[model samples]
Target: MGISTDSTPRYTYQLPVAAAPSEPPSAAEGAAASLQDALLVGNLLWFVRLRWVAISALTAFGAAGLLVRGAFPPLGLRPPTGWPFLIAALLLLANFGYLGHARWIVRNPQHRGAAWNLWVQIVADLLALTVVVYFLGSLETAAPFMYLAHVVLACIFFPRWQSFVVVVVASGLYAACVIVERLEIVHTPGIYLDPLLRQAMTGHSAFPWVTASSALGIFFVVWFLASHLSSLVRQQERELADANVRLTIAQRDKTRHMLRTTHELKAPFAAIAANAQLLLRGNCGVLPGEAAEVVRRIAARCRRLAIEIQEMLQLANLQSADEQPKPLRLDLAEMVHWAIARVGAAAQARRVTVDADLAPAHVVAVEDHIKMLLTNIIANAVAYSYEGGTVRVRCHVAASDGPVITIEDEGIGIPADKLPRIFDEYYRTEEAVRHNKDSTGLGLAIVRHVAASLEIRVQVESAPNCGTRFTLRFPRAG
Candidate 1:
């Protein structure tokens, strides 16, 4: 080997080039793609089943036509020979095989190449229809129009180019059949060809050719338009899917940023509030009334800022997919009492009285989330209520509906126009802002998000100055 290397270099063989790796789909992208594939597969399976049913029905009808031909001669239907019936039975068997194939594809996780299966079905259908049309007097009767069904199915289930391929193959097969018949290359027995219609449009010399050309033209035009429209619809769907993905990513990023910023802000406000509290308590030194009052106000403002930051954080978490709620069995009445207690100080401050009608109702929900939901709605009611107004909290199980918790307030009610926007984050009705200048506008947004996450239905009824009622319908948990 050393001696050979000294004299000449050995040739090295190059390996075949490998394909580049494709990017893996994200969870959301994968889910969306799976949904689209499922829809396509479902449509194809439905069409296949429908075709089987149609074939069975047509076979029965054909058999009946043959049996009753002499009995009812005035029906004007010519009795077909046994050959067509035999062909139909074979087609039915083929269709049964296809149905089995389709079922396997649907049930098997490893079978992802469904498009190929669909193409096979389309081609098989086209060939079968061509044979039937030939047996039914090719071009003389309306049997040739049966090709339109294949075209329509291809347009719906296959890609544009695939559909075009179908149109071409179908048109070619039909034209070839007509030409062969006209040339007397193959004679189909017991089949009627209408001579008048064939010779009506063209002279005898080119009548069949002209008729075949016109039929081909119609097939091409119909398929072209149908395929074009289908392509447009598919393109729009892809564009919409991409838009949704982008929107989801953008929203997730926004929520993450908001969560981080709020967390950062909370720490500083908490420290400031603690220091202000210490100063207000005269821990440093004795202070004048004015300075003490100012310090107290600073402490209160810091506390309010802290609460607002907390609300923003909660809302961000609720909007995020990362935060899964921990659901547990909870008594509705106890949660309602806890919510009323949490807002007791606020209610007392506003001079609002809370009335409750308790009922024993069990539901599966995240305790903190439910508590937060109840607190926000009840606090909102208390905030909007006038001095000495009544806030009613009711927990009951309706006969038709499951368990219900309603918070009704005799405070300043929301206007009908603003009801739709009340749950929007950072959105405050003008009345709400006037009622509580310190409102963060995230309360009802949190309520809605939590309710939706817990699968609880919330309904709001309100009229300006009359009252606002918030109804939460909880699905009973076993």
Candidate 2:
């Protein structure tokens, strides 16, 4: 997901540049690490896909040269179809290997570092391209320009020093090929007619020297410009990430302050309810009929407010820092049963029957949060159900062994338009409010927080006056 660009802070003075990605604060190192890993994997995949284009270009070049071989001598050209086809075949096999290696890195990240994977790819690709450059004539054709692809990519994905290394290696390989060819140590049938204007150009002793020198200069110049631009981009990305972290910290601190304030408010609300109860019970003095009715309403509202406040505090605790419960492997079916038990009273009061279909499904998550998450959803299922309705609770693992739990209810279903806001704290649809007067509207919000914390996905399906189904897909336990 994209963070809001507006969050980037404006500065009046220029900031000093860092040689590397600045370290994110200690609290968010994991985020930075994850981002880098993803970038590596993504770049690896991109390079593999792009290689197919290179292979096709080679194939087409070979086919075209072969088809028009008759016209080559007239145009002072002597291209070889066999070499291009051979290079294309080599690239085709290597591409398959690259694809397999990328998948292995994704599945078994600990086996190899991402940087090592990228470096291997860069070296292999440069070697292959070096061969292509030699065959096509580093000074004879535009083939040397292909090295810029690696230079630009290296700049984008690597630090300044690492990018410099790639530039040096590429330039060196091209120079080596050119020097050996000129020295007649390795013979190459460069694409030129020795009989035509080509011999005049080739006879110049300083021509290859100047061409090689100019190409190397351009390579270094490109590395400098590309790396500078890439560094600026990296700087912006780090700043954006830091800004997001700060925003998150500010939000958590705000939740903590709200948690503290709610704690203080709870007592006053309780006292009000207690005094109202005393009046209703005639503990102080007998009250007139109208006053008694008024007291009853006040007491009822206070009780309802107290429940809302309690759920609010629960949510605040879940969102606050330093309060997440430790994760342990637990059975999804067992948690579902425990949740059913927790909501038994409400289900019984509403005459709602719960049907459970348990399967062997397990996940690693905090026990209390799991219970709280399940209990809240189950309670809502019961509360919203019509009298004598049935709520189905199912737990099972998917074919991939990722656990799934579903809670479906035969209730006054959520309106399609209002379903989006159902998880918003304190948000309730008019239909929901009319159906369940005492609904606190925080149950789903709490469930959402727990699901997010556990890395579970919650998908809802509903229709007005029909029924609603919530599907919770849990990440496979490690």
Candidate 3:
């Protein structure tokens, strides 16, 4: 509901920068502005419609009163039919004019002038209601309560101070009407009747003073409560917006720091792996058996470390990218086959069996991210499974839930307590660390991040020594 200012710069550079030109809004910015304007116009139109309803009801009530007076002369209670008709006609004319103005503002939102428009409408409504109350016996009848309705409306659409101003002005006008009627300055009929209940009573009495005082007291109390509640809600909304802005800033800073550190580490590890591989292959010279075996182990570990650094860099880039990858139509079955092929070597090394039940289904997603997500899940399953255990992968469309991809493995399953933190970066369970010492613990984290970017839902079910199942549900593309 609130708009944030983009005064904070996104990035800084050492190089000299050129002055940027003032340009038109981007598509996203324009769409957001258009949506805001549309909402404002809708609110204004709704207020205008409510006024039309109020005016119609007033006209109908006036006509009914005139009919009752004509039919029963013995009642002897004179109603102000002529003045009600005149007031209703004037109100209808003003409402029709304001409706036209509201439509014009909707068409020309740049010139809407909301504050002035609201003030004019509210003041006019208060005046019209005061006239109606006067005609309907003022403080004697329940028509004075109508001012409270206007007070509530003002509280909803106006600022707290402005609504209070409305309460003050309305109370003053109604109090003046009561005073004049009590003093015979205007000969309006009162609500009381004679002993026979057939004649109206003339009053210069204490009842009007008491009624006016009570009405004013009620008005102030209603205004105070409504204004205080509105202020609290606005304050909460502003606080939430500020918190979100701070979180976004902190995330961007963390991503930048990780990207720089990982880039520096990757190069040295790559050189170390290359030199160790040369020595192990006898490219430099033939060495003792023990020396060659040590070099072989060093080369293998370095290569694995390099791969882990590369994955970390990929994750950092995914987090920092401002624009998301656009989704494209792709075959789910083909993507699953690609992922199986990716983990074929790992599965073979573990002596694990791979099974797939794929149905021909198409979805919309970034092809590379989806393929990488599948590869990570399947590779993790292969890495964790026992020798000769089964790794099952399935893909198909559900009757009510769109397309789903599931990978299940009879692996050393995660502990119940560690399930919640499994997807956190560098979070490996104790059992997992014992089974595979070289595990970087970044596979599930990568899987989670990629799935989120592609709008896929991932659900996990596992028990210790009972195997684990990971299910991914994809939304249908129109």
Candidate 4:
């Protein structure tokens, strides 16, 4: 419904800058403009149908003229039945042609043709309206008001100058129609459709000129108001869009700043944990029992915090990193075994049995990403499982399913309602937190991020007491 009449809007798109905030380009603007083109197409269809209605009305008026011609005297008014029918028939043919052109334009994807077709429709309608004006008595009837519809439509669909061009064209055409008839340049039986109205204006030599001037002024006033409002609306839209883009850029910059700050704290935390360990291990002089116990607790908390910090940094790095530059082929069986080994200590600590059903399958991906992805899943399975529970890992290539990996565990399972948030960074369900208080909650977030980077699909299934299953499906290689 909104239209721009001032400067053409410019659209551009660019990736977010790393060091400073900047406006991203309007990357998908063609898609945006297509909506307007689509709207224009719909409006054109509506107007084409409107013409059909006009044709019907004209035909009905002509029929009424014929019916009236026989019963009424020529004293008061006389309407020419044949001329009205001729105009309607001509309009019917033009409407059909316009409709066929519109259909042809829509069948093609390029919208440039649709715009030109609108130009033709508007101009052709104007020319037809001019004829209607002459027949209905240009200065005598209300036919000139019909020109305002096209004038308003032009302002909506085109820029200011083009709309003014339409206004000028309308004014000139109406003036010409009135003068020609008044001067008897093209003689007809009556100067007006209503004979009595023609008689009333016959003596007034300046009536046609005065009427034409008033109508021309009306067209200019309408264009000024419509085009001005349209320009204002479009400018506001652009300003709002730019403001939104700036807000998004500012938010992204804030996250990058926080993650960079977190990354910087990693070494200090590591050193603190190392020193605490040293104190507990008697690398320094032996501490008192109470001091030793406090140091032991301090070391554990530092190590866990260090792990959380590392995972947060990794998530940030993964988000900013480009796709693996030089991926290589690797055996899933070997990688799965390695990932199991990575989590073997945790499984042992929790008294959880880890089983692997590894089949020979080859996949191409960044070795480290897939390795970490699998390790995280296996580690999670072991972490959530009850003592003496079993965790199974499966890796195989199915004929239709391509390469697949599934890690299933008999753990304190996620609730159905909370399953969707399991991959959110630092997100853990109440049950997950209760079962394993040490979780960083970034394990599956990392897994899902890596899978997405590799274009792999992930599916999760779980029940409250029945544990959870994580399935990783690699897209079939072409």
Assess the local accuracy of residue 335 in candidate 2 as a C-alpha lDDT between 0 and 100.
89
Candidate 2, residues 244-325, lDDT tens digits: the string is: 7787667767787989988998999999999999999999899999999999999989988898888888888787666466
* Residue 191, model 4, lDDT: 33
> Which wins on TM-score, candidate 2 or candidate 3?
3
Clashing pairs in 3: none
RMSD of 4: 11.8
Native-structure RMSD, model 1: 17.8
**Per-residue C-alpha lDDT of model 3 across residues 196-307, encoded as one tens digit per residue:** 3312332435656777889899999999999888778757855764554555566667777988998999889889888998897789999799999898888889978887
Q: Order the numbered candidates by lDDT, best leading.
A: 2, 1, 4, 3
Residue 242 deviation, candidate 4, in Å? 1.9
Task: Record all residue pairs in model 2 with backbone atoms less than 3 Å apart, i.e. clashing.
Answer: none
Clashes per candidate, residues 3 or more apart or on different chains: 1, 0, 0, 4
Pitting candidate 2 against candidate 3, the one with the higher lDDT is: 2
The TM-score between candidate 2 and the true structure equals 0.69
Model 4 C-alpha lDDT per residue in residues 1-478, reported as the tens digit of each score: 1112245332211111122222233422444466667777787788889888889988987897787675445545566658778888987888888788778767875845667767887888888889878876787767898999999888877777888888888988988988888887886655344655676875577777787888888889998998898778767866776666566556556657768888789889889899998898899999999999999889889978988887776676566422345788888889999998988888899898998999988888878877888888898988888899889889889899999988888877767677767777789988888878898989888876787677777888776666777777887655
Structure candidate 4, residue pairs in collision: 12-25, 12-26, 13-25, 14-25
Candidate 4 backbone clash number: 4
lDDT, candidate 3, at 432: 94
lDDT of each: 0.77, 0.82, 0.75, 0.77
Runs of candidate 4 exceeding 4 Å displacement: 1-236, 321-338, 358-368, 395-404, 447-457
Q: Which candidate is the best by lDDT?
A: 2
Total backbone collisions, model 1: 1
Return whichever of 1 and 2 wins on TM-score: 1
TM-score of 4: 0.60
The lDDT of model 2 is: 0.82
